[model samples]
Target chain A: MAADWIVFWVCAPISIGSAIAMLLQRNAVHAALFLIVNLFTVAVLYLVLGAPFLFAVQIIVYAGAIMVLFLFVIMLLGVDREERLVERLRGQRTAAILLGLGVVGEVVFAIRAGVGFSTRAPAGFGAANGGGNPQALGRLLFRAYFLPFEVTSILLMVAAVAAMVLARRRERPVASAERRAQEPIEPSEPSEPSEPREEEPVG
Target chain B: MLGQFLSHPPVELGPIGPELVLAGAGVLVLLGGALVRRRQPRALLLASLAGLTGAAVVSVSLWRWRGHATVLGGMVQADRFAVVARLILLGVAALALVLGHHYFERLGEERPEFYPLVLFTTLGMTLITAAADLILVFLALEILSLSLYVLTALSRRLAAVEGSMKYFLLGAFSSAFFLYGVAMAYGATGSTHLSTIARSLAGQTGNQALALAAVALLVIGFGFKVAAVPFHMWTPDVYQGAPTAVTAYMSAATKVAAFAAFLRVLMTSFQPLTWDWTPIVWGLAVATMIVGSVLAIAQTDIKRMLAYSSIAHAGFVLVGVSAATQEGIQSALFYLLAYAATILGAFGVVMLASGRGEEHTSLGSYAGLCRRSPLLAGLMSLFLLSMAGIPPTAGFIAKVNVFRAAVDAGHWGVALVGVLASVVAAFFYIRVMVLMYMQEPLEDVEPDPSIVPRLAVAVPALLTLLFGVFPGLVLGLLERASVLRW
Candidate 1:
């Protein structure tokens, strides 16, 4: 139990600090590396919480694959220019601080409440996890949650189609006159490396 | 062991027949696009229409289930609530597809994926309506949003790219909030099924603080999707930048899907916490109405103005939700259908009005639309009049239905605010009508005479008047569907 507290105390600050550093870093690559560090700490926390599958996923998928993609995008887009950090929108900083403080206050209230999950017998994680966590997960996924598992394939297919559309070359057989009239960025876009469009952070 | 896991809970196919039909059709369109590369777009359009009609028929057929609330191991629901919402989503998706088909076809481009993606989005919308579990709900949401992000970016124009990017980012953030709420909910109740959550809450065995936090986060997530105030910063830009067809589809269909899920989740899983959540929804409703209407009056772009107007309509639906009664649920259903038909038709006209790369969506461009194309001009006025809640149109009855429900639920104060907001919303809607009818032509650019898209849009315009004049046509069924239970 004390080891649990020690693990939480040690991992919590590092995770949070890396997250803050990730936010403050101007160099995109460094920011991504910082995010990896934060994810590693989260994995450590997950490990201590007795969820090895999640810890593995956290490290392999997020910290490994996603960070690689982030860095690849950063390099390709040439957004590594070290510029002075400045707020593009006025009051953005103050707004950020105020919002951050509000979030912190909410978390503080939640912590002060100190209300862990209800310890009802059927509700306890350990009860369902007895036949091993992965086995339980497998059973649940196949039996109770079959529909979502199948639907995820559709989501991936849509994303594939989207990628194909965005990566199309200018030499494709679009109407020449309309292409010339409609697209100002068509010529330069063939190289496919503009300032990185907003990339959503994957969970 | 694997066989035991697979066969333990037998899955029901009847409840999800509409979703299956939609999925099969979507995949078929993708294959058709890939295989038959010549003159395929038109054929693809026909196939997609058949898909929608078939799905709607499957959904209608599910009505024989007659009040079955739990199916698929309580992971999916079968009820008139889901059936009606499915029909509405399919209707909107069909309109959006035809409008998009002609919009791109007029540009002389072969966008084969557009039809399939719309079908896919419709599938998601229909699936979410029937999602009885939190996991299924989130999955269905992703299925819809991912395709929508692609559809919004289908044009690959800078503006379209920007809109899709913003939508993708903000939507991902909100989805994370929703997932957190789901986690909290599961932790509190040890169940992801809505009925089980309700039972847990009713039994008072759940952690109150955790449940309350979960409710707040879940509302925030749905609020973003519905474009309620404070979470609606993306609405105007996304709407203005997206192709008019995509905007029309998403604006109408998304509200129906998200609000259906929202009604199901909050009104079911969190039913025991009704008093605790209503005040929050009340606040959201008030803010969404006041801000959405007032800000709409200041927009110059037709799409942006409509964006704000849609935000205001979201507030009206939230009013029904805040009432927290069976009548409230029925009225919200009516309001969603009304808003869907009205907005879909209105944007179809906007599609016609903005011809040639959709460059003519500004208010200045619509100075004399009536003289140039009286059919379009008249249809626009009718749709806008419905939006403004004028009598003899769907919007008026829809508004009255919601307010009456709120009053019945002892939420007369919110109903009163809703009435005033309707008046303010009327101003901007009427402003557009006045511009179309009275003002002189600003630019003599010819609007598209494309009959297919026009014919597609006219169905909704017809529906708007039909439902308004005879509200009883659908109200009787909605009354029964409104009786939501475990």
Candidate 2:
């Protein structure tokens, strides 16, 4: 129990502090690194709560894979370019701060009142057993949650298709013509082909 | 070990046969788009229509074979309500695809992928109506919404991209709220299945705060989807920015699907908390109707006007839902069917009236459309009249049924508000009509010469009139259909 208290006291602050830092950081890369720290600390906190499977998933899926993806995006998009930070709406920041504070207050009150802190597990909760999280989860998922599982797979496929469709660049002869017109006068060099080659032949 | 688990219970696929067929069709269209050397847009369109028809057939068969049954371990319910909703979605999808085929071909954008996306979206909508569990609802909602976001931007115009981005961000935020609500509800009831939650929440007054919070969160989430007041900032912009066919589909099919799920969740799982949530929904209904009608009167763009009009229709539907009675559900279902047909027809005419580059959507562009093409102008007038809830039109019957249900359920104030709002909404619809028939042609633009879009407009117009004259046909069908049996 003392060790658990120690872990909570140490990891909770780290997680909360890193989350704030992540939000405050101006540099995208620095923000991403802070997010990784926050995720790692949350994983430790999950471990302290005896959710070993969730802890592992938090570290592996979020801290490892997702953070890497975020860093890659930041680098690919050029991390040094500062965002404009335009305030499109009047009093937006004030309203955001007020809402954020309200949320924090509600959360704090809930925690203090132990609204969701129950020692007893509800009936039919499959995750009550220690060290059997993954196996029990698999059993419940495949047995009772099979339909949602399959639907989730379809959702992922739809996401992939949507990304592909949105990211695809249209082959425009007009664009090529404009590019050719903008090119410097090079009489000695043969004018580039009228139509750009179909890069990947959109299927 | 696997065999032991498999022996738990045999999974049944009959309940979800429509979803399966639609998903399979979507996959086939996608693969054909990827593999075929010469992209045949016409063939793809035909295949998508056939798939939707097949799915409709399956849905009808399911409704006949087993009118109501919880299947796939209670993840979904194959009931009369879901089957009917699926049929409506399929019909809307087919019409929208037909409209899209001509719209894209006219614009010279050969996007074969459009058909597959439509199929996928229809699949999502079908699953949403059938979903009996909260998890399934969220998954299905994401599938439908993500495809719609992409479809909104599919035209590749700057406005299209901007609208889609705003839609995607706001939609994602709402989805997170919905998921959080699901978690809270699960925490409260220890189950995500609507039947189980209803059972657990029945007559239990202790610890009601969490449950009330869950209800509010869920309502907020669905309000965004249905474009209710305060959560409806995205509707007009997205509708105006998206392509006409897509806007039509989004306006019709999304409402049908979202309202189906919304009514299911509220009527089934949250039924016991009616006293708590009814007043809130009553306020929303009033606001949505008034805002949608009044603001629409100020819009010059035909699509933007239609967007606001759709918002008002959503309010009328919410009036029925807030009543929370059997008659209310039946009337809401009938209203959805009526609105879907009428809106699709209205937008189809709008698509046809536009020039080759889709530049003639403004109200000014519609001036003297009667002189341009009498058939197009006549069809537009029929649809607009239907929207305005004129006598002998489907919209009038729908509004009357819903308001009657509200009044019967003792929501006389809400019913009154709905009637007054409809009166206000009629003004804008009439304004469009006056523009078409009374004014001079604005630039002598020719109507689109596509027979397909004309057929699309004609079918819905005929159906709207048929339903208007014979509301009893749909009302009787709804009478026989069992809803929320779980």
TM-score for every candidate vs. truth?
0.82, 0.86
In candidate 2, position B372 carries an lDDT of 86
Off by over 4 Å in 1: A1-127, A130-133, A170-203, B1-6, B66-68
Residue B142 alpha-carbon offset, candidate 1, angstroms:
1.9
* lDDT per residue as tens, model 1, A1-203: 89989999999999999999988987788888899999999999988877887888898899899988888878888874776678999999999999999999999888666654443333466778878777788777777777777878888887888787667643333455345557676664563465344443221
Cα lDDT of model 2 by residue, B1-486, tens digit:
667645767677888999999999999999898788767889999989999999999899887755337888889897889888998999999999999988887787877779999999999999999999999999999999999999999898888999999999999999989998898898888789998888888858324778888899999999999999989999998998899999989999999999999999999999888899999999999999999999999999999999999999999999999889898999899889999998888888888888775588899999999998999999888888888889788998989989998999999999999999999999999998899899998777888887878988898899899999988878888866636766
TM-score of 1: 0.82
RMSD for each of the candidates: 6.7, 4.8
Put down candidate 1 lDDT per residue, B224-305, tens digits, no spaces: 9999998999888888888888898999999999999999999999999999999999999999999999999999989999
Lowest summed lDDT across 10 adjacent residues in model 1 chain B is found at B2-11
| Model 2 CA lDDT for position B33 | 81
- lDDT for position A145 in model 2: 94
What class would a CAPRI assessor give candidate 1's docking? acceptable
